[model samples]
Target: EAGVAQSPRYKIIEKRQSVAFWCNPISGHATLYWYQQILGQGPKLLIQFQNNGVVDDSQLPKDRFSAERLKGVDSTLKIQPAKLEDSAVYLCASSLRQGQGFYEQYFGPGTRLTVT
Candidate 1:
């Protein structure tokens, strides 16, 4: 199967500006996730979606970040008034349901955002 796809492989934006990233998951996948990975650290789960409904977003910064998967096939993440601390690689991943839980995830190349 094809992997997840993300647009704007790299982006440069000023602090306090707004940016949006898009992701299209593989066909037939039931779960999608967005992650933020900073230099020298593990990827942090920002939000998760099962179909068009959000499954988890405890780690997401609700004040400045928002995401949605309206039709369960494609998703978008946006950051308003971006911060310097927000500079990182934003990753999109998807997985197929296997038995009781989701299976191995397939990841996209990610959108590298540099907040200036």
Candidate 2:
């Protein structure tokens, strides 16, 4: 099976600028996720989608970040007026449901964003 995919592997922007990131999950996966990993910290769940519908986004900053997976296959995340603290590696992950449980998630290479 293929792994999750993300683009614009690296981005450099000044604070207050806007940037967007894209993700494509592996085939047959039923659940997708977006996470932000700051340097020296563990990855933080930003949003989760279950087949084109949102399943969780309690940690997403509504005023600065947004994401969507409307087609159930691909998704996008955007940050407007980004802050310096927002510099981090944005990761995309996907997982499959097994029997009545869930499989471990597969992660993409991630896009590294640096805000100056």
Candidate 3:
């Protein structure tokens, strides 16, 4: 099976600017998720999708961050008017099911973003 794929392993942007990251989940998987990991903290789920429908997005910052998984195969996350606190690793993961304890997910290497 193919592993998760992410782009531009690292990025540096000035505060208040916008940045976007892309992800391609493994084939045959039905669920995809985007997570943010701040330094010294565990990954926090930003959004989760089951196929083409959104399963959860409670943790996503509506004012500055947005994400979408169109067509249920790939996804993208964007941070606009970036802030210094937004510097962290953005990870993409995929699984075979939606329930929390049902499926194991595979994670990407993650995109590290730095704000200046």
- Runs of candidate 3 exceeding 4 Å displacement: none
C-alpha lDDT of all candidate models, in order: 0.94, 0.93, 0.94
In terms of lDDT, model 1 sits at 0.94
What lDDT tens digits, residue by residue, belong to model 1 across residues 1-116? Answer: 67899998999999999999999999999899999999899999999999998989999999999999999899999999899999999999998852446388889999999999
Candidate 2 local lDDT, 37-115, one digit each (tens): 9999999999988898888899999999999998899899999989999999999999884233447989999999999
98 Cα displacement, candidate 1 (Å): 8.4
Query: How much does candidate 1 score in TM-score?
Result: 0.95
Distance from true location, Cα of 13 in model 3, Å: 0.3
Candidate 2's TM-score? 0.94
Per-residue lDDT of candidate 3, residues 2-116 (tens digit): 7999997999999999999999999989899999999999999999999988999999999999888889899999999899999999999999888866689999999999999
lDDT of 2: 0.93
